[model samples]
Target: MSSRTYPAWFHRVRSLVQDRKARGQAFRYNDDELPTRPQDYDEDLSERPNDSGDSDQSSILSDISGNASSEKARYYAMKEQRNERKKQLRDRRTGQGSNQSDDEWSEETEVQKELEIEEEEIRPIKEALTEAQQSPEENSAPLKKLGGRLFRLWSTDHVKYCTFETAPKRYIEFYDPKEFRGFKTYPDGKIDGHIYMVSDDMCEIDNFTPPKNPSLNFVRLDGNGVCHCFEVQFFDNHHLTLKMPKDLVFHRQAISPPSEAPEVFTYYGICEKYSDKLYRAKQRKEAQGK
Candidate 1:
């Protein structure tokens, strides 16, 4: 068969189409081996400054990450140290085995231990001193023994003189040894009308204060039938005396006691004006203008 001749334009168009088809088939079949699009020089020039900026950002991020990791490690290490210290303290307090070193017990702790030991040592001494410091008034009475019924007060056999600095009175007891009827003159110049018996040997008086000597309580009935109380004490069994209250004061004596009778005035005491016969006598004399 004879081939027909195409026009030059048609042959050109056909050749162009066939070339395009071949190129498309080559691109589809061999996509992996295809040449990359050529880079634009202008675009590369424009992105050059961004590359440097990205590098700087990456370096800063790496540095921050490294610092954060280091800080985290330090924090965990400090936490472990704190926990160990707490465990040591708990073990010591609970009497458990402790891992603490000897340096943990400081000088202040040693001083505190020494002070505690000293206090314990002195405790008995402090108690003894406290007992010794108590007042003498709390002690028991002394042994008072006068050969059974040594002497008596206000007996007619004995002449007694009151040498109190305030009052110089005299007393004589009118006693009937058989009848037991008797009366005695008091330091205040009043007569004691009560007929009371005094044993031979004086006994210790109790429930009274100012515990210097053996003392007793004496009750007197005056002429008015009123009872008054007096405290009586004796310097010795031979010398019967009176004991006065601490608050009572006496006048000065005109004459001192003789050397031989140094304690003769010890029986004297401050006189009560209301209970004194001499004072009443003086008052009556004044009122009567005598």
Candidate 2:
């Protein structure tokens, strides 16, 4: 006969049970010492009073409300942290901070360079919506006319334009007279941002010489306080073109109703509608290929 070997944990548990039994305390096998279920075990727990002299319902409600408030607090805290991080990044980029490692500085520098390249690949289109908000009399006729409409990127000279090439659909909308929003809808994700726009004399690409045709210059300030300047090469009722640094050309077409403010201000609805369109277009193209 072979002796049975027990694991070390099993021996520990057995010793604990034996110690309890020696002390006349209930062990695992002591069913008689266990408390019996109350007759009202099936009754609603919410109707019972808790230790604090409040009904269980009140405690549960308090817990639910507390969880919701805590979640909201956490969300705002995260947002503040993100804003602070972005501020630090901007400060470092502008030579205000020197504490960053060489690798970190190099990485951020490359990001800034990429953003500069992307800004040059954007285009524009016409029709203003909130003329009263911006005081139409203060802006040029061309600037005022460029608001309140959504412009879709039709074509771009740069094949590697990140926003244009990656997104199945992309749009730029001057939601407010001086505020512009750009959004791109991808198959699995979306990107959107808003920035304030102002007129500028300096062009990113053609700083040495002025544009040959009558061109409108715009300097856009993003959340990170980075300024991107692009020249509006042409703008009309249906078409708008932009000239950017490195001689990048972006042509845009007006998609929404002319001169009318968009019904929905947020990008969610717009992106949803466009995403569906993109899906259908892809299906059609696949069918044609077959």
Candidate 3:
């Protein structure tokens, strides 16, 4: 079909071609196998120029070219033009038009290049991952006891402990004492291997931080009464007494000996605030306001 009657896309291409010709621009995509440039376009168009004007003259001599009944030759000639048009359309669909200059194609080709580069880059990383998966588990440090005392939180069903830090966030209990699993003690309680730590309070556990000082014996209230030590022994249901220092009384509210007193604050003994961080934050706000 003629360019005027053809589809919209074909008209756009035809317009681009005409515009290129008027502007003296180079031709890019063309059906001819031979390479063409702007200068070559004029030559190609000149061959078919004003075919209508020469139509009558050309028809007068056309009788000598072929017989009217050369059915086979006529069939092949028409087939050739149809095939050529199909090829042209296919090339445009596949981004293969010669009119598509290298510059324009470069932009389109860049997308393809990027995809190729991504695949290339991912290949090495994938190979490394495969190799890692095939390998055995990496050597890790053996978990050994790093001597530190443990104290349980207040009397509750919850399992929590306080390492010497400001708050408690650990879950430590004397492994039934007779379980042979010993406890790690603090400085004063660090004698040989036992600890005299205390349970301050409980909160969200994080690093199992150890507490400071906290020996069963303190100048403050170390007494002949009940001893303040990290671990307490359940001498019986009614009496949970100090068991670390064989010769010590696990003091309760009732003082055993009046003249002497057990240490009031030790790893075994704990003091708690109603709200863990509330008071401190409130103080800070007040100070800032001042």
- CA shift at 91, candidate 3, in angstroms? 17
Q: State the weakest 10-residue window (summed lDDT) of model 2.
A: 34-43
lDDT of residue 273 for candidate 3: 27
Root-mean-square deviation of every model = 54.0, 26.8, 36.8
In model 2, which residue pairs have backbone atoms overlapping below 3 Å? 127-145, 127-147, 128-147
Report how far residue 232 has shifted in candidate 3, in Å. Answer: 46
Between candidates 2 and 3, the one scoring higher on lDDT is 2
Model 3, residue 163: displacement in angstroms? Answer: 53
lDDT of each: 0.30, 0.32, 0.30
- Ten contiguous residues minimizing lDDT sum, candidate 1: 35-44
lDDT string for model 2 (1-290, tens) is 11122223223333443444442233222434221111111122222222222233333433334344543343334334333444444555678766744335353454454344334333212222122235433243433233345544333223223222211233444433233234422222222233211111121221112122323332322222234444333222334453343311221322222233322121111222333465469769989999
TM-score of decoy 1: 0.16
Order of models, best lDDT first = 2, 3, 1
Give lDDT for model 1: 0.30
List the pairs of residues colliding in candidate 1: 149-200, 149-201
